[model samples]
Target: MAESTTVDIESQQAELDTYHDEPGDRPVLRARFEHNGSPRYMLYTIKRLGLDHEHGFHLDVQLVSDSLEGGVETVEAKLQEGDADLIDIDYISTARERADGAPIVAIHPYGRTVGGLVTPEDSPIEDLTDLRGRRIGVVRRLDKNWILVRAACRERHGFDPDEEATPVEAGSKVELTRMLRDGEVEGVLQFWPIVPEITETGPYREVLPMAELVQDLSETDRKLPISTFLTSEQYLSENPDAVRGFKGAYRDAVDRLTSDDELWEDIGERLMYEDDPEIVRAVRDGWREMVVADWDAETIDGMDRLFDHLLEVAGADALGVDHVPDDMFRLEV
Candidate 1:
């Protein structure tokens, strides 16, 4: 495949007078990311850092417009075959295990959850047990929400996902939401933001939150890993200052995301621009449930368990704990 046109930090900055910042003093950070349907909040954060043209640091973001599976394969190929300077990927658990020689820098966390229950009046599908015999529409079989939901059903509700519930796969969120509105599915399994968005649009009864089920089955400290950021190991060693600056900027973005309610509303609106106003509100509400943190021991361990479980489900070899580097969760400067 032909390589995309490269954007040089100094040259790009020099072209724009207003964006110009001291280039020599700042380090440049190059990154590539997968376009996972949702407008990524991290990208917004990166933009907010003003590193796009800063002198001491420059940040370049690229969008992988391919299928998620294809994107993953491309990322793995780039890491295994070439000498790329920077890479930022979604769903770090998979990348961390397969990165080979690349050093990874930690970033914010996000996870999957079942849609929030919306009711004309309150109903009994109050917990995982109530899901049996019900129809559930999912965006994709391999999506993280489906995995998390399957785990909850098996571990907590004692229900076999294939046996207990009807599973309908939709190609997009809009299609899935339409199914729910039409009474085609009793529940919808999706990530955080979409659940609330669907509920606000009406026709659905309620969102059966998967996180609450996980909490009930597991401990309060336990949480599932949905996604994270990473770069190559070789890049980190060669550009420690750049890595630090990126981390610092990222953490600042996380703080801003977690603290600002209006920002989330704006994000929801931006992401759900094609949807109805009610849908945007629902999306915002669902997104609010997501918790972002710098990966800690508990989070890392939780991800390890999640990967093991996923491997078991897929009937594949499990990734060893040693596969995750000591610095996998390192967020501190």
Candidate 2:
């Protein structure tokens, strides 16, 4: 099944490559995304509906490898090195990089890209208090989901999970899932996209979604976006129209994805790691609530408040940055 999915992704990449073979007079906006990530669903829609062209640009999509590969060449690396024009990253990481002099700025929000704490259905653990001494698997100690979990635990439960329980860093999402299935960990903080598959197909349950924690910590009545669309400062300054065009294309694609149920059927066959009907339905529904349809000054303020809360509870070291740069967010684009 995995082999077939890989082949399908490769075939899709080949097809997308042909779309911009000529480039013509349109400015080609090069972008990179994880090979099987959720963003591709919207990107596929944009290309299929000719939203990019209609908005005045040519979309050049690059499917990137997920492996750290010694952490040399990544989506962020491509953007910093001027090899690509756009990518999405969690805002905390963006702040850290910006503090260290990376010329990237967030142009738009990508939604609350949170994960959940998953345990086997029959497991005795029912809440954060039950995680006292059990092993929890995470992609990394510094991952945003784990940080949020720690903050929520400390604030609501009166103990830091980092000190009270054992955390096993699995190095990657795939390995984290394997650790849970193999009984290497009692609970795993898994990303949202992979959560439905485990809970739907097996005896697993999400104890809590980190999104709830984000809302509670930020004191917001509505969901706030944790990740954002990013591009180099130079790219935004030089090609302002292209950046705005991509935003229009993105908004249109999101609208179509939200309203068209049949379009999800195509996404399940083409972009998803698993094509199970239940999984597809779960993903489609989740995307509707998680993707930010639009953002205004209030949205940015909500994010700022969320950042302040995380900083206050988690500390600068835990967040990897002491402060958010003044120019970190640019909604003007």
Candidate 3:
């Protein structure tokens, strides 16, 4: 709500974090989240709550890996190997991972998205129907979204992405947009976060809300995939303060972020690839769709629906279990 003068990031973090670089009495919680917007929220929390000079422990978030591709997996491995404390549940909480009987659990409700599919602005395609017999540019990986796209194609049009249409993968969003802008692909299926930038900055149009597409194809009532902080059962037990502190700070950020135009503008100017007003507004609106207050009954229900859809395509063995564990959401010690 108020203006915050830009300061040295390292010093600001140290001043805001209860657990500074110097080891403190408060347990240091080493964590990594998809830097997409998660870190921005955390940083906002530090500023909003004046946590920079607060006394307590620290939640050290490694924001080096900007995308989830490398960061989430690296954190998941570290947590499983006992080198890190927290990571996203999507990384390791698959049915198969749960079936393995590992003690990982969703420690905090971070954010959620229903996502979207976009296409080139000049393309003749107007809706999902046009996607039939066309090539689409996607991310570098066969993410869950891609899996759902395959399902949607098979059910809606009897056209399989693998056989009837081409789904090309590029290294990053920039590369993907490059291909699309250069007329290499007819359409692009991407998530919500980068879609705004794609439409506002690049040559594209946001079409086919992906959550609706996935829901139509999968018949899932609540099409939501939660982005949460997950931790080993042992770690939660060991460092209760770190867990609670991080959660409180995160909630503080989300609670205030939506209405804080100044913060949003500042964040946009600092983080976005381009600093245009339209792009900032679009990105902020996209982030707005991702924020939530709690993992209430409805939220968890949405996760179950999504998990079921994933299970059908990815299978129990591939997902690592036969069911979604109830203990995935833990609010306290």
TM-score of each: 0.65, 0.94, 0.77
- The candidate maximizing TM-score is 2
**What's the lDDT for all of these models?**
0.52, 0.84, 0.60
- Candidate 1 segments whose C-alpha is farther than 4 A from its true place: 1-39, 49-56, 62-67, 70-126, 171-175, 178-186, 222-225, 261-271, 274-289, 305-333
Across residues 96-175, which tens digit of lDDT does each residue of candidate 1 receive? 44544444555445443334434333445666667678777776565545655666666656666756777787655556
C-alpha lDDT (0 to 100) for residue 71 of candidate 1: 28
Write the candidate numbers in order of decreasing TM-score: 2, 3, 1
Please report, as a residue range, the 10-residue window in candidate 2 with the lowest summed lDDT.
65-74
Model 1 root-mean-square deviation: 7.0
Model 3 backbone overlap count: 10
- Model 3, 233-282: lDDT tens digits are 88888877777776776666776677787777766655555568887787
TM-score of 3: 0.77
TM-score of 2: 0.94
Off by over 4 Å in 3: 1-23, 35-39, 51-55, 66-75, 81-83, 89-103, 171-175, 214-225, 309-322
